[model samples]
Target: MSKPLRVVVWSTGWIGSIAVEAVHRRPDMELVGVWVHSAEKVGHDVGEIVGIGTVGVVATSDADALIALRPDCVVYAASGPERDTAAVPDYVRLLEAGINVVTTTSTRLVYPPTFTAQWRDALETAAKAGGTSLYASGIFPGFGSDQLALVLSTQSSTIQKIEATEVSLNDHYPVADVMMDGMGFGRPLDFAPWLSRPGTIEASWAGPIHLVAEGLGAVVEEVRGSLERALADRDIEVAFGMIPAGTVGAVCTRAVGVVDGREAIVIKHIIRMARDVAPDWLGSECDATYRVDIDGDPDIHCTMTMGEMQGHAAGRGAMVATAMRVLNAVPYVVDAPAGLLSSLDLPLTLPRFALRTAHR
Candidate 1:
């Protein structure tokens, strides 16, 4: 029988914590190490940090320790709303050291072909040098933008344009920094959110747009981005904190790809702290929905709605779904060719395990 793959869980944030739990539970994977960024998390059992009890694996902040352990794969879940410049070098170091990586961070790394020449060349070179691979995926850019679009395009006879939309309620999400600093939620309307900064949305979302274009046998000439926000009419309280009246309550953003001076591919986000905040914008038929519309000869449209799973909080369910998307890709990525990859390059990653049932 083949041995379990050795894995290191990097970070313990929203997705990272879930990664630790997933790795611990997988029979085909072994939890060998945990690397953390927070000083307070140092020297604690990873199982305890992720609320899975003690698994006897201590979390460390030392990169050298991780290198010494020689893990086969690292689940990179570190979050950086401002695009921490150091993350690229960190991945470069890990790849050069011969460790494969599957991450939910760095959306630009999701589709290597769309990335800048310097960044793409560096990562590809590192992977070739180490004979390992790197894969980046998540709920939106990973599944909604690239995977979903491709799946829906099978019905299109002559595709003219495609738009992928994500409408999610952020009230249940517990990340304060993501809601406040990154999204500008609860801030005054005039304040620019992190995503609204120049070139931020384009850099982060264009990869997926290009991936869709490539899948449809077309090329996106230019990708443009735009953002708009709505102010709250009354104070509202959510999981993280309270939002005062007149603050930003909802945001709608889009990254549109132009082919031949016409919009051919688009990614749209409609995020609201409260369901009532953005009445004019698109609302999900369910609690949260990922909708992909293909405007073409056949005109295909598909939607995915995720609600409470086994009575857990809605936001927590979303987080787990995102983690699963990354986790299920592990085996396929390990066996794939050594290079930076996109969803299009991999086979369908289906979950091998089933949910526990009450029946004995």
Candidate 2:
């Protein structure tokens, strides 16, 4: 076999930890180094950072030193409030240094065509200069909805509408900023949150919608976004913290792409802290659910429910799966043409390894 691909895992957060584990397990991959932003994790072994036994690799805060090692690829998963401002330059710098990058940092990067010209051009130019490539993927915008929807459409004869729905309970999601400030989860009903901003949903979900449109040989003429919030009747507790009565308990949002004045492609999100919090809004029967409906000649409907995996919770299962999606694409991204790539440009990226272990 060829030499294992040298890889550096950037950051060791919830998602980053999983990426680290993935690199260590894959026989075709080698963990060369690790970069961490938090001062506390700076000197620990990478294995200790991810709860595995010692692998003899130490974590470092010196990004320059890490990059100087010249790993074949970097799995970028650092995330925070400044992610938007920071990740772009990270991508450009790595690509320009002749290192391929696969990340789950920015959702919009899943399909680079929908990004602003300035951002797209910079990355493309960097990739061209260094002869490298960049790919971003995850469950929702990556495979669970956008790519899966398009793949299923091939079985249709006359497609009329395509709807991808994600119905999940965020009680155990464990992101306080996302639930409180970003989503207004515990805020009053009258308080407008990030998801309710005009055109925000449309812009966020446009990547997947346009991908579906492109896959179906059509163009999106317009995009529309809307959202509704539900107030809690009583105090409730979630992974983040306590949500008091009369605060926002659930949210239902949609991004609809119009084709010839019709809602041709739609992406809907139904998130609730508790099922009773928003019985009136759209919902699902399970803790985590993803459904794709295609209104075509045969009217295809595919539903995927996320449950426990290897004795992990549904939310944990989802996070690991998302990281695996990006890790599995590392080889394809390295071999792909030197530029920004999407799931459409690559073949199916399955899990690198599997055991006979069962979840009971």
Candidate 3:
């Protein structure tokens, strides 16, 4: 049989830890090395750092050392609230070292065409230099944004509008930066979250909106976004931390793709620090869902919800799904032509050999 694709996982944070586990479960992939940002995680067995039993691989903070291994692919699962600013250099270095990258960090990279000349050229230059490729994906900008909308468009004969929404119950998601710093949940009403900044939503989500519009042979002339915050009247519990009374407990964000002065493609996110924070936004029960509503000749509404898997944490299926989506694309990214790639550019990703055995 062909040698297992040599792989390294680049972090052990929220998604990074899970990515390590998913990569470990793959018989077709070898977990060769792990790179870490935290000094505490350095030298720990990757299996142990990720809560999996020891598999004999240690984590290293030295990027050069891990890159020196020349693994076939690196799952760049590190957090990048700043997107290109934080992760681009790391990606460039890995690509220049002939290491392919699959990242969940940057939503902008999910659609390469949305990038400016400099960022696009920078990655392309490094990728071509070492004959490697980089693919960015996750649950939101990754699949729920472009893939779900485009895939559901198949059933439509006449297209009018496409709306993609993600309703996440973050009571179990404990990432502070993501929940508080990036998304602004659990913050005060006057506190400006990253999601509230100008052009933030457009920059982060327009890729998928434009990607969906592109795939459907339509154009989005003007992209627009909106945000609404829900405050907690009383103190509440959350995985990240306590939601202090009278703080922002929920947020509903919308990015619209305007075509011919009408909303054509739209992406919305309803994020709750607790289960009932935003009851009118979507469902009331605590769960994660990616739903696409298409208004066309034959209207269609499709929603994908996640349930616990064998190895992943209970009520954290969506996070696991996010990691697996990028991790499962390792083989495809390795085989793809050298450059930045989007979902539209790659072949269908399958969970190869993932269905066979339960977690050992």
Candidate 4:
């Protein structure tokens, strides 16, 4: 307790860079090492790479070398194509080396029991062998759906249904693959989105559905995914590209949890390249908003948005929100018992010494 917690950050992507700046300013945490995926980033100071003034900790691509340092925890922020499925081994490797890991990469690990039996066994076994913990969390499946929904249920006398819906205005979102390919925006109506694929939604979002049900003492018999795409009424230009008239401009997708042969939990998203594209779809006051709706004897609605000035949203700040959700949990995760952890197991994560001057 006399020394600051030793911390390492993995990857230098959007999520990782924000983590570097946050950890550097925290008085109770010491920036130890940074792991980068790109070869060009090797040997550069992490603070410089993240655009903060240099803080002396240089970046490296050597995974084994960082493990040798045996930091208290690693903020595994690596994200790319299929990271949720591909990054399990990376996390297990760190756990086996006796290093605690808190990541925003894997959605299945949000509730460790929700993943396949093989992955579940592997993570549990690794954590047991090394006596460390692994916690996965982020905005959607992590907070808005699972944790936030459960907290709101405390007020209701009777709970019948829980749903987390995001009506996001993503015209300002510039990620090409996510905008065009993942959501099917600017594509033909017949174009198949990855979400439309069978089991894809369940694989990505079922953790939160199961977690919500488990938290409420219910059972989920099935999870279903559905999609609806609206065509652009006129020529629409987005941050990534254009959506011509009669082309896809909006998508409304839902992953529903059927419990006791009834719709109990749902994760719905109405994503738009232009707000007016889906006139009748769910709309928000800001550019992006997450609304938790609990239908029961006394209905409860909770709305959440970040970095909204007036009605516009800070698209870049969204990444920072995701990064901090895990970063703030480091103290609890490091001290917790060795195993896979979810929001259910963690105590209130306080941002200790964050208001004081930087200890760097």
Candidate 5:
């Protein structure tokens, strides 16, 4: 048998660490190195940084040193307050070196089209010039927004409209600060701010909506957003931290891309904490639900509901699933088109064990 693919894991954050675990368990992949942003973590064993046993790999922040290793691929899971500025450059550098790349950045949804147009073009050019490939995808807008929408289209003949909805209890927050502050949890919030804001949650999903609309052979003229918040008066305990009960901590946002004032594609996101007691539209026990509505010949509708108890598991599953997808595509990306490619454009096939293992 041929030697396993050598992969460099850049970043040890939440998703990065999980991707490390996923890579280690795969028989076809080998972990060769790790990259981190913290100086304190430098020189430490990669296994310890990921909470696994020693694997002989040491963590370093030196990009030049990492590039010198000549890894076959780079799984980038770096998180930061400044992701667009700092993290993106790292991935681009790797791509420029002709190394395959897969990332979980939310901004990745707009590749080659909306956001990072120049960078996307550059990466595509580099990948093509170096015979490498690069792809980006995640669970929310990545899977549910793009892939699932594409799947729903298969059920339609003359598709007219498509709608995707996601609802979750706030318990899915991985980091307390981001959940409580970045999301404005535990505060008397106004939904208007997020809807009217240029770069808020509503705006973030626009990329996926546009992607789906274009894929469905429709041109979206305008987009509209609506949001609701759940408030409590007391505090509730959660794995991340305590969120004030009865405070405006949970938010439900719905954005619709319109063609002639009719909804073509709808993206819905609901995030809530333990204090949220509001009844779900479908009445599932504090779980997350994804529903796709397709108006076509047969009127296709597909729904997936994940139990609330599996929120953490699902988040981890998303990380693993996305990583495995990237890992599986590395070989083909070497000869793919010369431009930013989304999950839709890349040649991706789910690994058989990925779903079974992630569900566990």
Candidate 6:
């Protein structure tokens, strides 16, 4: 059999920890090392940190130590509010060191298109110099944005419009905190706040929309956002804590892509807990839906609903998928342009032996 892909996973937070477990389960990928932010976890076994059975690998806070291992790839799943700020530095470092990288950072979606010219130039230079590749993709703005739209394009003889939606009922604090505090989930609905905010929900998904639009040979003329909130009637005790009832703690965000003042693509994101009142218009509980409408000789409407089960599955699944996809591209990154790269540009086919090894 061919040698296993030596992978070093950075971080052991929620998604990061899960990704480590997923990598351990794969047959063709060997967990060689781990990078952690805490000194306490530095000497601890990776399996212990991630709550899996013992695997000799230990976690270290030093990036240089992990890099010295010369891993074929690094699966970056570090925990933080801003992926660009928290993860990009490490990503650039790894790329410059000639290690292939795959990350769940939000900024990864716009690498080739919307990224800052400096960052873009740096990444490309690093990759070319190091002969390594870097790529990013995930569930929300990643697959939901690019992959789904790409899939829909296959069905359309001529494409006209695309709309995607993600709604979830979550009560966990850190997760909910990102939605409520970071996303302004319970705040007053206003376009001014979104327009002024640089990385808010509206602007965050713009990269994905632009990526897909560009892939489909369409140009986005205009993008607009709308936010809606649902107030609870009474306090509800959830896994996180007691969220006072009647508090406006849920939000629905919509972004419409217009071509010549006509709606061509609309993206909607909804974050809510089970206790929140369901909207009469949307006709569903806390669930994600992706709908595509194509105007052609025969009109086409395609919808995909990810309910409680699928929604819950998304967090960990997307993380694992992103890591595996990235690990599979280490060879290309080692040989291609550096800086930042998108999953759309990577080879989708993974080594069959790697899949078998991962499963084993």
- By TM-score, the best candidate is 2
**Candidate 6 residue 17 C-alpha distance from true site, Å:** 1.8
Relative to the true structure, candidate 4 reaches a TM of 0.94
Clashing pairs in 2: none
In model 3, the runs with Cα more than 4 Å from the true position are: 80-83, 175-178, 284-286, 308-315, 358-360
Task: Give residue 175's lDDT in candidate 6 (0 to 100).
Answer: 56
Candidate order by TM-score, highest to lowest? 2, 4, 3, 1, 5, 6
Residue 189 of model 6 has an lDDT of 43
**lDDT against the true structure, each candidate:** 0.84, 0.85, 0.83, 0.86, 0.69, 0.65
TM-score of 5: 0.85
lDDT of 1 by residue, 1-360 (tens): 379889998899889998888888777788999999889999999889888899999999999899889998888888765453667787888899999988888777778887778887899999999888999988887787778889878877898889999988878777788888888899997787787899878877889988888888887888899988998899989887988889989988899999989999999989988778879998864456789998899988888887652323456656777787878888888888999988988988886553533211
Q: Give the root-mean-square deviation of each candidate in angstroms.
A: 2.6, 2.6, 2.5, 2.0, 3.5, 3.5
Model 6: per-residue lDDT, tens digit, 1-360?
A: 667778888888866786688778766578888888888888988898888878888788888988998998887777666667666678678878878887665454443666656766777777777778777766666666566667767777765667676655555544555555565444344423332364455566667777777777777887777766776666665565555665655667787777657777777766665533556435333245445555653576666555454336333433455454544555555445555677566555354444253344
**Model 6 weakest 10-residue run by lDDT:** 187-196
* Cα deviation of 245, candidate 4, in Å: 3.0
Off by over 4 Å in 4: 172-174, 285-287, 310-314, 357-360
TM-scores of all models?
0.92, 0.95, 0.93, 0.94, 0.85, 0.84
Q: After best superposition, candidate 2 residue 194: deviation in angstroms?
A: 1.9
**What tens-digit string does per-residue lDDT give for candidate 3 at 1-360?**
588999998888878888888777877888899888889988889898878889899999998888889899999877755657878899989999999999988768888888766878889999999999999888887788789788788788998888888887666776788888777777898888888899878877878888888888888898888889999888987777888988888888999999888999989988776666767678634357788888888989887876642223335677778898899899999999999888888888988988778764
Q: Between the candidate structures 1 and 2, which one is better when assessed by lDDT?
A: 2
1 against 6, candidate with superior TM-score: 1
Model 2 misses residue 340 by how many Å?
0.5
Each prediction's total of clashing residue pairs, residues at least 3 apart in sequence or on different chains, is 0, 0, 0, 0, 11, 20
What residue runs in model 1 are displaced by over 4 Å at the alpha carbon?
82-84, 174-178, 285-287, 309-314, 354-360
* Candidate 6: regions farther than 4 A off: 107-111, 173-177, 186-199, 281-297, 305-339, 349-360
The 10-residue segment with the lowest total lDDT in model 1: 351-360
> Distance (Å) between predicted and true CA of 250, model 6?
2.0
Residue 308 displacement (Å), model 5:
7.4
Error of 1 at 279 (Å): 1.0
